[model samples]
Target: MLSTGGVVVVLAASVVVVGSVDRGATDSGLTGAPSTTATTQTEVRRVDLAQPFAGTAAAGWQDGAAGVVVPVPTPLAGFSAEQVAGALTQVRDVLITARLDPEVLYGHDLDRLAARFSERDRADVHTNKGYRTAIAPGSTLLGVPAKVAGTMTAKAGRPGELLVDTSYAFAYAFRPPDPERVNDPLHIISVVRVRTQYGFYDDRWDATGLTALDWSSYSYSVDCAAAEAGFLAPSLGKGGKPDLDAGDAERDAFDPAAPMATESTC
Candidate 1:
């Protein structure tokens, strides 16, 4: 359990490896490759907040909720095809509401997101410090849409439960209070990779609704101070670069297929 503002949210300490039944490819259009091709000479261009992803790995990622593509649902051992489909849809809705919604991200409002969880889990959703990426008070996101790319899968859990797993990388472009002062795109952009497992229970389980059973995430190019205080602020706001040493050296924050980081690398 992780404590946030004196509230405890039960989060898995390690990644959950659920055996998945292949239901064909998902609607996600990711090619598992960087959108921009590498060139012999690096091109230098001025950072434009409006076109924040112009020169980054997320340049071709889908905008906002479009990236969360649900896979075709198939019947599991104890679940019907319709049940699987409904679970997938519900999970997708939760992901969009929790991560991509401007109200939750910029306004720090969790009402819509918390409503997606079971009654028992709603409080956790409301109080979990890292559950959502909220911009600091002094800064605001640019009008440009956030870049997203990820995959969703489903599997059977226990006897009458469905487990939907989602993994995604979200890139947000922030406009500093004084945009003219920042010159590098990395300083104004932040990437957050989230991996979550949502459990849907039937009559057998005491709880009969959906709950986020596990959660893990990692953030890049963000201010350590804001992150510590449970807010997302670009590193440029603090007059420094991201603390890369806190994260895995080989991991790329923009890669959806990359493993989910267990802890925040602020």
Candidate 2:
């Protein structure tokens, strides 16, 4: 659990976003669908205020290290235990491989880091004029810590949906003359995270063989229930701008079949 003075709120906007590439990212980690591959066993490691990025409240994270498990739910049914295990292992391997790729991404294919997304995932990639874009090659980066400590929580979304939340505390160090100066400030982390909301989603979204109902949720720590509550900050407070920018544009001007837009039916 995040033991900072308290949990503060950080608006979802103004923060760098990534994932699925279709629905974009939500402060609560709910991106239309296809959140990611949720297979790894989650183990939460609460921080001790000594870790980097531990002071902020809205970050819903505190000091210390954490191992985060970003879960991507699948919705298919009828699977032997072996099939489920095999599928998860494959997903894990691919995630690890993503690091080796100069692009720093993960998905079903490896072409131009496009493998970071699946076919069904592409369905939701349709740009509704939401300022969508993919990560440039080598532009993606992460802190694969040797001893990553983290926090996590799960909640209800829109009645039946479940939300798994995780907060990160990252501290990267370099050996050099001015290590102390550059090291401390270089640690960039969100005081809060998107409490990802998912459901018994049994479809193409999941790379793992596990399906809805079969979907198992885990995280770095279960104690995050309170720490990350209400972490999804407000969207852009546009104050009633062109709310129908995409709707108006696509409603008449843009073709629904444009390759840039992705989608699928329930």
How far out, in Å, is residue 264 in model 1? 5.9
* TM-score (C-alpha) between model 1 and the true structure: 0.77
Q: Residue-wise lDDT of candidate 1 within 94-174, one digit each (tens)? A: 888877788887655788877777776677767664567777788788878899998999998777778888888888888
Q: State the lDDT at 189 in candidate 2.
A: 25
TM-score of 2: 0.29
Instruction: Give per-model TM-scores.
Output: 0.77, 0.29
lDDT of 2: 0.25
Residue 143 lDDT in model 1? Answer: 71
Top-lDDT candidate index? 1
Cα misplacement distance, residue 210 of candidate 1 (Å): 2.0
Q: Which sections of candidate 1 miss by over 4 Å?
A: 1-45, 204-208, 237-251, 262-266
Q: What lDDT score goes with residue 64 in model 2? A: 24
